[model samples]
Target: MYQPLAYRLRPKTLEDIVGQEHLVGPGKIIRRMVEANLLSSMILYGPPGTGKTSIASAIAGSTSFAFRMLNAATDTKKDLQIVAEEAKMSGTVILLLDEVHRLDKTKQDFLLPHLENGRIILIGATTENPYISINPAIRSRTQIFEVHPLTPEAIEMALDRALTAKDGFKDEDVILEQSAKRELAFVTNGDLRSALNALELAVRSTPKNEDGTILITKEIIQECTQQKGFSHDKNGDAHYDVISAFQKSIRGSDADAALHYLARLIEAGDLISICRRLLVIGYEDIGLANPAAASRTLDAVLAAERLGLPEARIPLSVAVLDLCLSPKSNSAYQSLDRALQDVKNGKATTIPNHLKDSHYKGAAALGRGLTYQYPHEFSDGWVAQQYLPDPLAHTRYYEPKFTGRYEQALAKRYEELHQKKSSSTK
Candidate 1:
């Protein structure tokens, strides 16, 4: 009759909840919603151990509405119909559906009508992105509340509760060293349930001395949790951690590290996510400086999707190599940042009249194209004229890097223009 430590230590109230104070604390959105009984259909989106289910349960238990629970992984349309029928009789039913994204389009459509009629207040829990997984119609009817992963501090608090809770380790004479507790927390990676489970196993495995005391040291916790298998399944912290490491490696220009992380994801059956991320990085990070990088990434995505794993490794390797070998530039990224900063500082410059559109009537009379020089009409396909707005005419925002095949020509053209302008000024 040994119950799981996570179950025994589950928070029973909002006050008992270990983390996410931002949402559940005083004056927060969720708090206001709960207190005011403005329980609209909502989607609680977050990774595991972020207390999605706990929040739903706390709200349902505290509210006046009748509550019902269902899991999309196992629940069927028939189950939903039964719940819908009961909800109609109850006036306002809070339907707590776990893994709501697991419901197919047909099943999700079944709830749309009832949701629209205000018969059921759907509180959904999904670890996946609602944009891709949840039906658009169903998602439209619900307010999306994002719940982030529990922080290390939050996980530590949960561990403390588990060690001392009556139903958890009250009967055991176990003491965990501070170092051992930190190690468990780190290994859990902000996963409260996993942390508690590791702590329970560590305590259980520790041998009691003849002195009648059991000690959980760093070594013991490490040993117990080290053997635990890690997965790259979409729902868990490992998924985010691996992808984060991969992105950081690319950003840092560590080709070897990027490849290693890519291999890890591939081995864990996360090929699709890996492919998708590569495509995103191509545009978001490796853009313009090396245009070929984006094209290569897109090709890899198509290859991975078409061929599937093992075989897909070929294209994955190609994409990673291209990203690693491509000349790095954050100029595009920096330009956007600079533009936003300019706007924030009230530096909106006026457009030069010469560069303004001259196709419209009265544009020529207003001196729109009076001094405008067409670059294509010049011998070198370059013209020395003011391109920037009047206020920012002397400001230079784009400074091309002298790296990569495409950017080398860009760098040369920029230098030539600068020389020409400097000579003319003298």
Candidate 2:
């Protein structure tokens, strides 16, 4: 059973690590802790394959501590007990708990004391934000450091290491062209594991010459990775970046760029994410200007969900196109934020007595709904009335954009009503 290239080529020492200079670099927090042998319980937070596990393994390598790993979901209390017993005699056990955020109550309670003291030096790795997912008690005890996506330069370094290292392809007699190498780095985005796997696929699948010299070109690399070769890392930065691009492109009304990003996500085959993002873009960016477009986008998303992949992309693309071509207006989004901000800042205003609910047992004796005119009784079905809080009575919140007919109509109606109210007051 051969290990995956990423696993086999994992850095044995902290120095061999590829990225995350903020943590692993000389004099950084991790390096300093390692140097002083004061390694404390900590959490390595980041996107997958950004070297969280590798860093944990490297810590054991560097410190000569007994290393043991267990999945938070599957490992039993008995298994943890075994590690604890081993640690008591072996000095300290470096425990690498994958998906530590998923740790159950039984195991969590058992590990608490061990983690608090020096018996079990815990290194938990999670792709999800620990602050949101992990137990607060456990979180408070450990130092948290974020592992960022590998830069292209760092990915290139990892590739070079894989090609030349003894544990990697050093003895394979393969010639990877510089252009091909760069393509692998670029296609993998910031995921070195993805690059290594693609490299492994290219090297193993492609034929060698009579002399056993394997020549890997950019075309061969592309073929191995299926050309698109992207590692979206679902919850990662790349995923967020694509979503951001899809939204901004549509908001800027650049149908071409928006479609390109749509194709990228479609190629990734994440219908759920694509569907969710499309709906958000429709409402947040194309609101007011094309309110109906948001509903249509929802319809398209439903269609895509039912149809699934390739076929689903059609409806998604339709929604994307409609949103891009529609008049763009973020005014509604801004207005809501402004009103919410005022509320958050403690700008208190009591609800007007006239507007208070009058349907309750309390009658006109308390003047709960006094002077509240019923607009429906008026011939025009309109009346000059104050519905806002007393302090906010004259504080206008909605500023409809004039880019579309619906909002422009709203603006006009609002202006007329305000003018009439003002004249009546005078």
TM-score versus the correct structure, for each prediction? 0.65, 0.77
Question: Per-residue lDDT tens digits of candidate 1, residues 1-426?
Answer: 878888777665677787878888989888888889887899998778778878887887778787788998898999999989988788889898999988887778898999999989999998887877788888899999888778777887777777778987777777888998888877776677778888888877778978887888989988888834344566554578789899878877789999999988988888778987898788666776798898978988898889998899998888888887777776666777787787788778777888788998999889888788888998988767777666666777776665566767777877888889767667
lDDT of 2: 0.88
* Candidate 1 accuracy as TM-score: 0.65
Candidate number of the best lDDT: 2
Best by TM-score: 2
lDDT accuracy of residue 368 in candidate 1: 85
Q: Taking the tens digit of each residue's C-alpha lDDT, what string does model 2 give over 23-55? A: 989999998988899899999988777899999
- Those runs of model 2 whose alpha carbons end farther than 4 Å from true positions after fitting are 1-8, 149-153, 169-172, 179-190, 194-228, 231-245, 252-257, 295-312, 325-327, 330-370, 376-381, 389-395, 399-409
